[model samples]
Structure formats: structure tokens, C-alpha cells
Target: MNFETPSVSLNTSPENESHDEQFVNNDTLEFKYKVLSYYNEGKSINQCAKYFNIDRRIISRWKKVESQIFQTKIKRKRCAVKSIIDRSHFPILETQLYSWINEKRHQGICLSIILIKLQAINMFNTIYKNTPESSLEFKASNGWFGNFCYRKNLVLRRITTSGRDLPKNSVEIIKQFFSENCQYTKHEFFKDWQHG
Candidate 1:
């Protein structure tokens, strides 16, 4: 009985040849599996190059690093994505801000984007009170706010407005109640006031 080894073809088009070649080169795991498969089947290095459309030098390098790759499970060093605010830049301020947000959340308060931006500005001001002229200014721009929210996995939801019209004198009644209540000082009453 006679047996013949099966032939493998990359079947790449001229348009996609470079793209496919780059993918195979970048994908270490797939390349390793292919190399091992061809080697096990008694295929030559030149044969692998012709079938896989990869360089012979790359195949030699892969062979040299095969043991290390298998040992490390093909782990690759990845560069971490940078954030808008670095903790190293303003460590204390960031820590305080994080704590304040957690405290507010624990109190069951819903935060809006505007509210967060305002609070961030306040915190930045308070932390840098002595260094007013410092170059490290925190404008708390919309882009920075957005990135902060993303980094913290916090979602800012808008308050739903009621469409119904209020009765005439509702504002007067509210003002009267606030004035009569000893718990609300005149300053606090006006500060928390919202007119519809």
C-alpha cells in the first residue's frame, strides 16, 4: 500500500495577498499551529514558505521561539491605553474626587453631567486654592468629563421633565412653606430654589 501527503494552498488573491500575509505574520498562535502541523507531516521549511506564503527567516525564528511561546501561552506585551487624567499628575485631587462621587452615590443621589462638571470644577478649585496661577489647570471641559465618566464607568442620565402645567400659585405656596419652615434658612431656601 502507498500513501501520499496532502498538499496545502493559501489560495490568496493579488488584491488580498498582502493583507492575508500581514495577518498570518501578526497572528502568532495560528502561525505556530500551522508550523507544527507542517513539521509533524514531514514538510520542508521551503514547503511551509510556499504553502503559508511567509518568509523562511520568520519560520526559523518561530521554531527558535516555539518552546518559549508554548511555555508562556503565547503571551504578548500590551501597552495600556492612556486616560485623560493621570493619577500621578493630581493624585490627591483624584482620590478626593473619587471618594466624593462614591459618597454621593451611597446617599442614593442621581448625578447629572452638569452636576458632575460643576462638582469637578469646585473640587479642582478647592484643591488648588494656594496655587491659583499653577499651569496645571483643570477646565473640566466636556471632553475631559466624558473621558472621566468612561474611566469610572459612570453614566450620566438626564432628568425627565413632566409635560403637565403646574397650578397658578404653586410657586407662592412652595415659597410660603420654605419661609415657615425653621429648618430652611433664607440663604439655603434661595440656594435650593427651582422655579418651573
Candidate 2:
């Protein structure tokens, strides 16, 4: 209650803000949780707002749904908005993207959020390339990404290695490398091995 709103917050939370004008609450989900924790620690909403460089009104809104915010952070790493988004926005584009994701997942390739969003924008451009409206663009905002995950039943999890063991075909790969690259007599190790 003792906090006053500044004219404009020029600097936001470092390393967590995206200067996206449309989706202003571009702070990471973890950051949001931290802000709420700060507020819950007997700090005023206005104080948390000023300290975090976010709007006081936004801080208040987050306070109302503090529990949900924490749950969201647990479920995922980032969230653009806490409210529900459009159920179905881009049908064809989403269908293609979902399929692309499944295809890559099957290939044992884990795609990051940035990579997925970038691919989404690329797909959007390609899908709507012939559209008459030049304003049809997709920035692949985090909100959209969240909703996309929800609709597609995709879960984002931290990348962890299954084990530290090398591949079972390691010996074959090494033999292939030596056979393909260095058949010449210029290398001492190769000369010794050949003689041996």
C-alpha cells in the first residue's frame, strides 16, 4: 500500500523479458512464481511490482491466482498468460506443426520451445504466403505456444540424459572414421598400428 507507480518501467527483469509489445507479460513462469512469493512474504503488491519492474495491476492479478501461477510453473517452464486462449485459431497450420512435432519426436530429436516457435512462424509464413492480406503474421508468442501445447497434449520436460554410456556401435564408428580419412602413411600412430 505504501508503493507508488512509476511513470514507466524502462528496465524489466533481466534475462526473462521479451520486448513483445502485444504480450507484455513475457516474464518466465519461474519469475512469475518468484514475484508472487515475494508478494506473499508480506511485501505489498506495489512493492513487488516496483521491484520486479512489472505493472502493479498485473501483480495484483497474479496475486489473485497465486496458487494457479505456482501450479503452472510446475507444469511447464514458461507461460504467456494465465487465462484461456482461443481453442482453435490456425487449423491447418497447427495440424501441420503437430504432425511435424510427432515426426521429430519419433526420430529421437527433442526440440526446444524456441525451435518449435520458429518452425511455427516459418510454417505460418509458408502456409499464408499467398494470402491477400499482408498483415497475416505469427510471432509465435509464448501464449500461443502454451495454448498449442495444451491443445496438442504435448508436455515439455527438462532434457536429461538416459545414461553416460557411449553407443554400442562406437567401435564400428571409430573404424569407419579411420578407414575413410587416413589411409596415408603420414601419421605415426597409424604407421605403428599398421606395422603391429
Candidate 3:
């Protein structure tokens, strides 16, 4: 049996009447320029996002990154540097945090404990406030910390079937649920379980 292969011709211009879609409209280019200009004028990405009804992140990428690469400089300030993760502090913070994690592990405390302890020590809110990816809001005795961890990919999430809170021994229950349903070990619970 013989099979015919599909060929793509790069030599022929799509605009040269050689392709099915041969028209490049000027309006599209004009609209793009307008969007870029709005972005260049120090408008918040959210503002441009609302104007276009697109995701703020998309507008941010276009304004701070994509636009800089593609468009001419237009009397605009450079994109403001957002508060960033300080790696120098990570070694110190991670050591302290993991030490606390170990202590909590011995007590059969959950990962939620680390978050709570951090907040109690006044470290979570102060030191990590400037960290871009750390949104450590303390809702003690609530599972918001777990959801935050799941969102940040610090741990995989087992889909919660209901709005109801998991029972006591939630970690073990969650671990068991994942073991039966998914093939991966829940590493987020590993240190606690190991110490316990």
C-alpha cells in the first residue's frame, strides 16, 4: 500500500494568491496598534483587560513583554517591577519552615499547621507579603491554606466532591482517596506522615 504525504510550501506567499486565505486586512493591524498604545500609556493591565474584556494576565504579558518586543517605544515608562521572590531569603525561610514542618509532623499536625504557625510567628504575612506567588491568608481551622497550596502547585489536589469540610484526620483520608483514585503519592503529606 502507498500513502500520499501532505506537503506545506513555504516558498509561496500566502498573500500572493497562492493560498486559500490570501487577504491581510489593514484593520487588524490598526487595532493591534491601538491596543499596544493603550498598554504603553501606563494603564494598569486590569484596565486594558477590562477594556478588551480579556484576562488581565494576557494584557500584562502583552504590555510588559510582547509589546516591548514588537512595538516602537512610545513615551512610556518601563513596566514597573513587581515584588519578586527573594532567593537569598529562601534558604533561611525554607530551613525555618521545614524545621517547623518537622516539629508539626511529630505532633501529627497537618500542613495547615505550618501555615498557621508561620502566621502566628508574624513571618507569613510580613516576610512573604512581597513574594509574588505566596498568598498566605490565614483562615485558622479552615482549609483555605490547603486550597492555596493546591493552587500554587505545591501539592496536587484531590477534587473535593462537596463544599463540606473533610472529617478529622483529613490528611490521611485525602491520602487514601488519592491512593485509590490516582497513582501518585501525595508528597505534601509525606513529611507529616513519615514523622508521625
Candidate 4:
């Protein structure tokens, strides 16, 4: 009754872009950076806020976020200081993606990160088509793919299906066994087994 589970390798290589860099040049983040930069360069916060037609409190918050933005820009690339999850992902989309992945695996398909990401993008497009949001960008970046794998306890690698070693002719043996059994009734097969 004992069994074993096959081991799988996790994809640890860095993607084309750092996860932090995924948010680079985000309009809102860049706007905040510009606002803070202008403020630092002799413009008042109020003036920057008025110029952007945004609230002063938001400006103040961005001011507090200035250091984080600077650090992000310096360390890697421009990134949002405050993570806005509004467009990060759609939960239902991800759930459907997970199911799709499982279905593919069940069909003995080995899916890679690139394939999964592409599938995610395709699913997103298909599901949201005809809606205003369809035009919105959905990169299905490696970060999101990795997060999806992590959440679903899935790995992005070749599926390894192994079991206790059997004789090399196991397939033929199985076929012969089934063929023999098909020619016999239950009573005769078990009567022979009882003798064996």
C-alpha cells in the first residue's frame, strides 16, 4: 500500500526583467515621481497637485512615498512605491488558468512558463473580449506566472511520472494478462489463482 511522489524542480531563473521592473514606467508611478521631482526642484506640493489636477492629500502621500520611489529607481528600475492591486490580476481569470493548467497536465502536456503565460494572456483576452477592459494591457508577466504556480502548488518544468521499477517487458506482460483474462470467466481465473 506504500507509494512515492516524484520530485519536481522549481523555476528559479530570473525572467527577462526583474519582478520589480515589471511596474517600470507605470503612468501613475511615473507621474508621482515627476510631481515629487518638480516639488523638490522648487515647486510647491500644492502647485504640483493643482497642475496634475489631483488632490493635495494624494500629493502628500506621494511625497511620503518619494524615498521609496527613488530607491526603486536607483536599485533596479522605476516601480510603484505603493502596490496598486486593482489591476494586478483577476482572481477568476487565475482560477480558470489553474484549471486549464491542470487539464493540460492531465492530458500529459508539459507546460513551460512561457506557454502558461501566453495561455493566461489568451484566456484573459478571450474572456474579456467585447468589454472595455479588453483593450487594457495584460502582460501575463513572469512574476504573475510564478505567483500562479506558487498559489496552485504547481511547477513550471517537465512533468516527471515515475513509479516502482517493473520488468522491461511489463507492457507486453500487462497486455497478455488482459488478453488471457478476457478469454476466461471469473470463476476459472480465481480457481487457477487459488492453486498458484
- Per-candidate TM-scores read 0.39, 0.39, 0.21, 0.36
Candidate 1 per-residue C-alpha lDDT over 41-97 given as tens digits, one digit per residue, 9 for 90 to 100: 998888777677777776776666566545554345432223344544555665677
Better of 3 and 4 by TM-score: 4
Q: Clashing residue pairs in candidate 2, if any?
A: none
Judged by whole-model lDDT over C-alpha atoms, candidate 4 comes out at 0.73
lDDT of 3 by residue, 82-167 (tens): 22333332344444555655676679755544555455346455556778636545432335445433333344334446587768
The sequence of per-residue lDDT tens digits that candidate 4 reaches over residues 1-196 is 6576535435433552364355344346566677788889998878876555567887787777677766665443444465433343577788898899899989988787778888889999998888877878999877877777766678677647757889999999999998968877889888988999
lDDT of model 3 at position 68: 38
Badly placed stretches (over 4 Å) of model 1 are: 1-91, 131-133, 163-196
Taking the candidates one at a time, how many backbone clashes does each contain? Answer: 0, 0, 0, 0
lDDT of all the models against the reference? Answer: 0.68, 0.78, 0.51, 0.73
Write out the backbone clash pairs for model 3: none
Report the error of model 2 at residue 152, Å. Answer: 1.2
